[model samples]
Target: MTDLNSKPEIDAPEGPAPEGLEIVDIVVGDGAEATPGATVDVHYLGVAYDSGEEFDSSWGRGQSINFPLDRLIAGWQQGIPGMKVGGRRKLVVPPHLAYGPAGSGHQLSGQTLIFVIDLLGVS
Candidate 1:
């Protein structure tokens, strides 16, 4: 069987990124290092910056989701590896790096995303 989850991109951005998100500054991981184009598996909790409502997570995957950091929302792609194993952090990702102008459908449209991430283990 094919693992439909193997694609390494989130539909790609249709045009320029949205109007709010910023890259801040990229931080490197300690031992849990993840390069710009590498994948990082992790556990996380994501919330909407506007409504503070929970949007998505891998915590309920019954295990950690092998989140391909490179393929993830730009916020995560740049934010996840700035941590060490067992480290926790808050990512203030603006929408430009998140879902772009369209915002990944409805849940994220015109909004920045706040994420509380734990660098449980990186593979």
Candidate 2:
């Protein structure tokens, strides 16, 4: 069972990166569902697909984050909707949907990222 209070672990991916976004639910919640543009409170961990190196984590910061879905990456905007509070989800986001192409200037550009997100609340 997934522990919503703790940070998640992502195994190194095998083979080539996927061509598109992949969303998987780890723990399904029974609370209010999230809308496409809703603000959310979540705890998340992010890692690089190729190296399995951790890039970011809300748990590392000692708290969850709250933000509007539309203000995040495309992968998030597309992946977060339909989730519910108390759920945990994994999203494999390609470069285009994440930080964009190699020269897009964001540190994570040109790379595929994996995120395990715990939904704490939605508004």
Candidate 3:
């Protein structure tokens, strides 16, 4: 079951945001949402939100990964649970919540991106 609770960190109650991503309800849904520290497994595809250019994806690599909630980006930690088994979601992540100014293994910089994520299951 997917949980839907608005969080201050993800929702950024203090307006747009200073650093990190914010969730805007473009398509509000009836599904379970992720807790701040819940471990989950999923499939996802990321693209530049502004340019619509594809950057990364589990689909492109033909594989899915299961990692601790702490192992992923801060934005994903707050973004995954809205999707249930066989469900999908669009996560718009800002650089701060992602890899920040330093970026990560993906070389992502101050880029805002969108992810078309498919939640296969949670373990």
For this target, which candidate reaches the highest lDDT against the unseen true structure?
Answer: 2
Ranking by lDDT: 2, 3, 1
Per-residue alpha-carbon lDDT of candidate 2 for residues 45-121, written as tens digits (9 for 90 to 100): 99999899999999999999999999999999999899999899999999999999999999999999999999999
Instruction: Please give the CA lDDT of all the candidate structures.
Output: 0.58, 0.94, 0.61
Among the numbered candidates, top TM-score falls to 2
Per-residue alpha-carbon lDDT of model 3 for 7-118, expressed as tens digits? 1112212334234454444344344554556666666767765566677777667777677777888788877655455555667888877876644556777777666665
What is candidate 1's CA lDDT for residue 49?
62
Evaluate residue 45 in candidate 1 and report its C-alpha lDDT on the 0 to 100 scale: 65
lDDT tens per residue, model 1, 1-123: 212222111222344433544433222334665556666666666776666667786664546667667778777876665566545556767767777556358657667676666555666
- Superposed model 3: Cα runs more than 4 Å off: 1-34, 102-106
**What TM-score against the true fold does each predicted structure earn?**
0.65, 0.98, 0.66
- Which residue pairs show backbone clashes in model 2? none
Q: Let me know the TM-score candidate 1 reaches against the reference structure.
A: 0.65
Q: Which stretches of candidate 2 lie over 4 Å from their true place?
A: none
